[model samples]
Target chain A: MSADLLIELIGVGKSFPKVSRASDRLRALTSLLLGRSPGRVSNVLEGIDLTIHRGQSVGLIGENGAGKSTLLKVITGVYSASTGSVRRLGTIAPLLELGAGFHPEQSGRENLRTNALLLGMSPAELAASEADIIAFADIGDYIDEPVKHYSSGMVVRLGFAVIAALKPDLLITDEVLAVGDESFQKKCVRWMERYLADGGTLVLVSHSMYHIQKLCQHAIWLDRGRIRKQGDVFDVTQDYLAWHEKKSADTGIEHRLTANGEYAVLRFALNGDTGTLPIELPLGEDLLVDVELRGRDDRAPVFGIGFKRVDGTAVYGTGSEFERQPAKRLAHGHFAWRLRFPKPSLLPGTYVITAHALDPEGVRLFDDLPRTVIVRGRTPELGLVRLAHVWEDPT
Target chain B: MNLLISLLAHFVQREIRERFLGTVSGGAWLLIGPLLTLAAYLFVFAEVMKVRLHADAGDSFVVFLALGLWPWFAFSESILRGTTAIRQNAALIGKIALDRQLLVQAAVLSAFLIHGLGFVLVLIVLKLSGYALNLAGLPWVLLGLAGLALTAYGLALALAAAAVFLRDIESVLAQVLMLGMLLTPIFFPPSQIPARFAWFVSFNPLAVWIGCIRGGLLERGLPDASGLVLAGGVAIAALLIGRFVFRRAAPHFEDYL
Candidate 1:
């Protein structure tokens, strides 16, 4: 192992025996005693190959039941892998499930002492930092009171305070920031920023994309106990968010196909592609919508174009009637419209482009068609669309 | 190794504190409880039952019983507490990664420390009251107690691991310990048992330990070489086998727990 590499896991896998039944437990006990794999197991992680080097902050993002906690446990040595190997160097402080080892009957101070010792702090080191921990927690006299009387936030405060004092080589935290109050959250974030600035390695697991992108330079996305993506933080988080957007779009609302409407959309395409596949457009490029509409009578149909995120959030919408520009009449009762957006400043994400054919009065909706468009690029900017801005230096 | 020792000391302190927590008299109960049991047994055997030792015996019946009873309590109590140590700390086992054997060792150590202190106070009272005790044999008696503690620790390790998988071990262990106390020669002298059943006493390891201590303290003599060898063999064997079973079952304790 290189000295710079803090952790290395190659083909690591973990499985738990199905010991719900009495006979199964007995069988498992016998097999374990005989040094064999227990029969009938549920594999939680498989073929995980990863290496975390010194001074690298990596974020772990995954849905619920995606084995994020299990992988952390395996890395922290709380759970040994059922197969393959995991080699780790340097000290690690895992803030998994805050106050997990705290004895409720004991005082907060006493629990801190025990936890610090368990985290490999010597008695002298703990004694030296005891005051710092108490002050950092800032729970007042509650530190002397039994831990059972403490509120949940107080517990988290005490837990984080102890780890902060330890200053371990590698810090692995799992959603620890979601509990504390806003000011305390800011304090912890500031502390973590300083810790990272000091070249400490971190592995953070959180559902909040903002925190992941802020703290981590690299990210790994786990889906169903497997690594779906791993790369630069922006790219992985973008892919993760797009996947969630697509999932919600699949389940959120269904679009109605009005084939027999009076003013139906005969054809709707983005950049001359009339297929169901989503059009991949580069960021900052122009977007063109070609629509061919059919009307029942000799009335011109109004054309409306709109953009929405896959999650049904409207980004931009407009109608030709609002601008007093009518679509060119191709034939009797048939009209065609070509709308152009020159250099749209949309962010990289999945969006749905909808073309609507309304009555000439633009008050009654008649027919609408939706097409998917994916804006592909890499940037650290957030939100749906970018606004023109400039940063002025202090004079 | 230093960390292990430090952790063991912390756990032992915690175990001792937890044992006396919520009690009115707190730590005083450690000595008082055993002393009361001694008083009750003394009243029953020495007064009501009119029990007496052999005519040539140097010590009274109460002394003989006290010498045996205190050591037995230390050994049995340690084993009982050690057997349940893992289950009692299932919360910690599931959360943190530490040496699992430390829990069992701490449980046994705390039990012995408490009972050992009580035993020392009783011996002081007996000696101050002018009862005939071989003060020179006290070191041998201490050595005997240490041997019994090793055996208790070994059994506790194996039993504690097994109890995680088999809950019935806890209940069954209480019954077995009760039966074992009767079979051992704690209440009566070895000479009193019938000739046909003398082999049972010879094979019972606890009997050998109690007899060795009793002989050193009451008879003012060293333990026989054969009994010493047998006791030593049992203690070492129990330790090795117990450690083997414990290590094999420890990693999977989180799953079963």
Candidate 2:
């Protein structure tokens, strides 16, 4: 492990024993006493080969329970790998698990001392850097009080304060910047920018793609204990987000199909076509959703369509039942439902369009289908839906 | 090794200061708390129980009891604190890449040092009251404290490691130590034990250490040659074994947490 290479993990793997019951733990202990292998194991990380260089920031992007945290631990030397070798160079400051080293009974100043010294700082070094940490924390009188009395945000401030002051050669953090108020988070981002500019390396893991795409040059997408994809930040994060959208839509469709009631949704498509699931369209363009349903008998049913961000934040929803327009049966036991938006005016992002069949009153939902759509635009202004307006100047 | 010791010493200072941060008296309470315990024990054991060990050694039972039991108190306090040191500082263990033994050693040693402070003053007062004071015994006094400290660190390593994996060990250790006070000659003298069980006292590590110090303070000089050798051997052995157990257990500590 040379100094310039920072960190190297060659085919690293880690396994944890699966002990759920008291009897299982006892059996494991007995095997150890008998010098035999313990039963059942689950691998949390497998065959990961990654090399991070100095002054390069890499982001780990994946869905929840994707083993991102386990990889970070392996790199930080907290948990030894069960297979292969891990060699790391340069000093490391890990901002893993917020307030991880802070003792609630001790004051912030005291915790600062213990945490810094544990990070390998000498007493003289800590004393010299203490003022910078205190000023950055900005907790004032709370720095002297026991940390148990501190609010959650104050604890985050103190934690970030220590990491920021150190400016270590390699900074490995798992969502430490996600805490605090927005302005403080922004400040931490600015400080991180400066830190990276000074030729520091970073291994960052966060759920926010905006932060990852902005801060990291390279990204690795982990799935089920393996590297799903590794490439530029923009490509990897976009792939990860797109996968999330597809998975959610698949589940929603599965729910509608499994219900299999008298009324059932047969096919759902967007843009009057089926070329791709998330049909691409420009902003301020028309979006058409078509839903085919089969009813046990010829009865008018309410049809509704709604749109939401890929993350499940609602953008716009409308039901024909609200407009008191019941669908008419075009054929025996089969009805065609269509909703059209002449101009969506949606901001540029991935979105889900859900079409559902309901009773005439719209109180009871019988069957539903969901499909994802991608909106493209060149607008600089931010938000879910863009509204048409003309600017006027007062003279 | 130099770096490790300095880091250990740093943790010890933090442990000492953090122990009494909230109270108005702050660090002063460390001295006062042990002194009060001494006063309370002297009243109950000497005046109420009316027990005496070696008549040739001294006239005051409180003096004899204080001299013999101070080291044992150091041993007890250390194990009590050390047993839970790692579990109590899970935040520190998971976040920092520190030598885990350093945390246990610091907790145990700080407990010894604070109690050792009170014992040093008690020895001074005894000398002023004209109780056969000799500089030759000072070496034995130092040796006895070192033995107790080493033994405490060893026991702490095992107990703290065990407590992390098996949480019940903490409560079990507390109960065992409470009863262990009777096994050692703290409240009463070793002579009170029956002849059949007298070997238990001689073999008990804390009893052996107290005897070593007693030999130096009130006697001609030095403890029994064999007793000093035996006590030092146990202390060293415990330290070695404790280090092994701690090292093996340290890697999986995060998994348990």
- The clash numbers for all candidates, in the given order, read 0, 0
Candidate 2 runs further than 4 Å off: A1-3, A19-40, A181-183, A253-395, B1-3, B54-59, B220-222
TM-score of each: 0.93, 0.78
lDDT of 1 by residue, A1-395 (tens): 37799989999888877877777877887787888877888988988989999999999999999999989988988888889899989888998788888999888998898888888888889889999999999999999898999999999999999999999899999777778899889988889889999999999999988788888999999888888999998789988988989998899887765756688888998888999888888898998888998887868888888899999999999988888887789999999888889989899899999988888777778888899898878776788999999999979
Off by over 4 Å in 1: A297-300, A329-334, A361-366, A388-395, B48-51, B220-223
Candidate 2 chain B minimal-lDDT segment of 10 residues: B53-62
lDDT values, one for every candidate:
0.87, 0.78
DockQ of each: 0.65, 0.31
> A282-354 in candidate 2: lDDT tens per residue?
7788987777777666766677777888777789888876886556577887778677789888876788777
Shift in Å, residue B125, candidate 2: 2.6
The CAPRI quality class of candidate 2 comes to: acceptable
Candidate 2, pairs of clashing residues: none
Query: What TM-score number comes out for model 2?
Result: 0.78
